[model samples]
Target: CSNGGLEGANNGKITVPAGVTSFTITTPTVDDDLKEDTEAYSISVGGVDATGTILDNEEDIEVSSVTSDTQTEGTSLVHTVTLSGEAEAAKEYDFTFNNGTVEDEDIGTLQFSNGVTYDASTGKITVPAGVTSFTITTPTVDDDLKEDTEAYSISVGGVD
Candidate 1:
């Protein structure tokens, strides 16, 4: 009950003594299971003001470890990739950069340079640990003949 406690409505209630003005809640910083990354929720304290008055501002509960942002599809997408968190020892993280939708399966015709090469066998890139960021190069393609800019994404969850 102490660890992994949910303060959401119908789940649990946060109460403070009559003299107390505010209270603090605990949250997990990291997890061993990869599935437990991050979570967030909005909380609204509603009741009699005799006990404590909740703030008028929007309150949010954020539980997170790793996160990602959407990348636009383009003829040339040179992304400076940065992994999450810091590493104490030198190691490697296996990851993947997915191109197009699953139904379409279009990885585009753009070419990559330097150490950025696609591996169809393992379907992941071996990134050395302790390295926060690295460059991924892609040559521009002639989009005049193409219909539109396709979709693609990058992921780091495959890393063990």
Candidate 2:
């Protein structure tokens, strides 16, 4: 997980072991004042301690492609990370982020911004502008048995 207390900071690299098939990375949502810009942050994943070469050859997972839309000025974004390879079932992986910073804080929390919308049908929260980030810490179980229970704990940082 990245973007918690340390915004615009880098924590360095995380090592994933071999035989692991999938993993999830969590990033904290940011709440910030609207007047600021140029929030700098970065999250990187690497296979430093793996028994075999990391497949894909990509240095780190690209979060921008998966959750770019959610990083808007005043909205909370949730993104799920999954591996794309064949390995043992139920294997686990861990990812860590390089420290960084977000410029705005007042815009992060829902109460201060335009508010959020929950779509039961799509299972998504729509955040408005001026907010740096939003995260769902706990997710209610879906009506369908096929869905898994999910929870999120997020924090946003900026000028109050």
- The most accurate candidate by TM-score is 1
State which candidate has the highest lDDT. 1
lDDT of 2 at 116: 40
TM-score of each: 0.36, 0.20
Candidate 1 C-alpha lDDT tens digits along 1-160:
1323324424656544455555544443443322221345444555533232222222221111223333443344555554554333333344565655422333344343334445558765543334445555543444334455455555544421
Model 2 residue 70 lDDT score: 31
lDDT tens digits by residue: candidate 2, 47-152: 3332222222223211122222234223344433222322221222222221123323213322222244554465344444333333332212223233222223
Clashes of each: 2, 28
TM-score of 2: 0.20
Which runs in model 2 stand beyond 4 Å of their true positions?
1-67, 85-88, 103-160
Off by over 4 Å in 1: 1-75, 86-90, 101-119, 158-160
Error of 2 at 39 (Å): 49
lDDT of each: 0.42, 0.32
Indicate the residue-level lDDT of 53 in model 1. 27
lDDT score for residue 85 of model 2: 29
